[model samples]
Target: MAGHSKWANIQHRKGRQDEKRGKVWTRIIREITVAARQGGADVTANPRLRLAIDKAKAANMPADRIKYNVDKASGNLEGVNYEEIRYEGYGIGGAAIIVDTMTDNRVRTVAEVRHAFSKYGGNLGTEGSVAFQFKHCGQLVFAPGTSEDKVMEVALESGAEDVVSDDDGAIEVITSPTDFEAVKNALEAAGLVADMAEVTMRAENTIAIAGEDALRMQKLLDVIEDLDDVQNVYHNAELAE
Candidate 1:
């Protein structure tokens, strides 16, 4: 697997416990609220809300808490209003980075984000600066030991766009964002469970960074991710393992 994938796996595992748990919940709650506000409280009729609910369930969030947020956002109760924002930037070695946020305070969010970039050896860029380097899609990755042939067969038959096996034996299935839930359900019905699956901004290409540059880039990413308003951080940097 590429170092970026490895790093993502590490973060995924680590995010479930300790201080990161609360941060994870905060981000998920924001997502659920936004999804509900945009669509509706009914998961079956709202794909975005359904995805957010799935993430909440995976994180072991209480059903009542999840419902409360949805109800509040759907106007059953008063709630804070938030706006979605996307910030593009450059990391170590000029690698492209994109930060997604939902905030009630745009000025505060922007300042904190800009400070994080400048403090971490990165430069904040204008809109569309680095977003062109990514494709919005749904991706599912299976471990090295998984059966690639079976995955390919099932995925392609179930509305998947592509199936690719990396050098490290990881199999990735790509799908349109709209087809993500359907494809995922089909895979589960076929007894295939992914190690990682999500709708994301997938990088089209990567910048390889090593040694000191890699360390700095990791630090930059960490700071950006730690920001309260930052919901998701995507980058095109492949760090040295």
Candidate 2:
């Protein structure tokens, strides 16, 4: 598995704990609000909203809460206006990092992000600073017991770029953003259930950071992700097991 995949696995494990604390529901609600605001309240017609709703449902977010947030986003109720932003930076040991956020105030969000990086021995960079070092790809993960060869065959047939089997017993499929839904549907039709699916920024190359640098990188990621405005953190830090 790649660093991104490793980080995702870590998050999944931590997410259960987050759920108990109600943090997962907050994040899911933010995503739902943003998605509905951007693409309207119709889940069937709004792909982004559809995905967010699916995630919310999977997380066991209450149906009434989901509807409330969707209504808030669609102007049926009052809510904060959010703008999506991406921050590119470098973490300890020069590992490239990308932070995705949805905030009502861009100035406050950027300052908070910059402060976290600088405090953690990292530096915030200009736009496109480290983006070129990564590839924006669609990822769909399948759990263990799914036939790898069968899954790979369907993914490739549905325009996926690659299928990689990991030691964690999960299979990760890569595809272009436009082909993601099709590829996912194909796999599902073949009796494969996707554990997680998202369009993510994947590092084309990664840096192996050990000891102090690795610890610093994790702290930086935690700081960024703990921000209420931040949604996702992508980095090239090769987290050791």
Top model by lDDT, which number?
1
User: What's the C-alpha lDDT at position 122 in model 2?
Assistant: 91
Model 2: per-residue Cα lDDT over 75-182, one tens digit each: 999999888899999998889999999888999999999999899899999999999998899888777667888988899998999988766677889999878888
Worst 10 residues of 1 by lDDT: 1-10
Per-residue lDDT for 7-103 in model 1, tens only? 3443444553345888999999999999999998988899999999999998899999999999999999999999999999999999999999999
RMSD of 2: 2.6
Candidate 1 lDDT at 30 equals 98
Over 4 Å off in model 1, which ranges?
1-19
How many pairs of residues collide in model 1? 0
TM-score of 1: 0.94
Best by TM-score: 1
